[model samples]
Target: METPRERWVGADAGPIVRPYAVTRGRTRPRGMDVDLVTLLVATGRTPGERVWLSREQRRLLELCRHPSTPADLASDTDLPLRVVQILLADLHQYGLVEEVPQAEPAGRSTGRPDPKILMRVLDELRRL
Candidate 1:
């Protein structure tokens, strides 16, 4: 049988550190809502001396210099989506990052669709 070290010694070996280790074994972001389309931007506040940031966290901050979505951040850093969300939540808690409010689409006033339009669509579906 091949030793574990020998088995993982080649270029084919996967990531050295697992995602759980990076997030300290936390599977979810704390008290923060994050979704694929949710926009995130840096708050322009620098981390204080007391703040301890991991390499991944620093990389996230750099990527958030401009408005970014969690999906984009994950893709850019080549990290898992959950890991990015957790790191972003930490930055958000520190006030180093903020969520950007999405604007309503142009030519739309209310969030709810018109009842009449919905009824018509339903009627069409029923006909089908």
Candidate 2:
């Protein structure tokens, strides 16, 4: 049977678009590796329009601004660790963040995922 990963077709290659925060940076992408924190703050600018964020997503973004373990972030944010993992994966895939590997999960653990998986998923999404 085909898996979710195998089911993708196309229509997902386009860049991801998300609203930014209050602060932003000046340099353009052609000049430098974008600072995600600065870029996040720079993306949203609808003069009179309002921006909204859930308490959890906001907290998740804050935790992500620093290099931290998913377990640590989940504990700090009071969210289930798995949910934190999922959110980070989403953020990374959208090019809003990057991740570095840490210790491996214990044998009894469900196991951590590889960030490269998102690249494959992104390609599949593009194909779909």
Candidate 3:
């Protein structure tokens, strides 16, 4: 008999679930768009009070109990950015979390770091 293809196993030897399964075949989120640094805050809903939330959504609530960025959430959750974004969107629809984009400083709003700030930091590092 031929052996089946190897399956992914976790540290506990549990079968690994695919990412797409978690999103229910969604490749994109349905609500507000999010960037890497979009801040998220939990709505502080207690367990058993949440209605029809997925495990990913619950985990997102726990992680965002303290203000955190989507990038941070992805890193901490070991999930892809898209997956986290989708979860955040779901939480948003349920009013379980809020998305706040990081405001860029007035002068640096054009997407480039100010050269003066970089020079100052370089000078300080050289002095140290």
Cα lDDT of candidate 1 equals 0.90
Order the candidates by lDDT, highest first — what do you get?
1, 3, 2
Ranking by TM-score: 1, 3, 2
Candidate 3: residue 79 Cα off by (Å): 1.0
Candidate 3 deviant stretches above 4 angstroms: 1-14, 45-50, 101-128
Q: In candidate 3, what are the lDDT values of residues 8-127, reduced to their tens digit?
A: 656574667788988999989988776777788987755456567788777889999899988999999888899999888888877778865567887666865679988998999999
User: Pick by TM-score: which candidate is best?
Assistant: 1
lDDT for model 3 comes to: 0.81
Tens digits of per-residue lDDT for model 1 on 17-128? 7889999999999978888868899999988889899999999999999999999999999899999999999999999999997777689878555699889989999999
Worst 10 residues of 1 by lDDT: 7-16
Most lDDT-accurate candidate: 1
TM-score of each: 0.75, 0.37, 0.68
Off by over 4 Å in 2: 1-53, 101-128
RMSD of each: 6.1, 15.9, 6.0
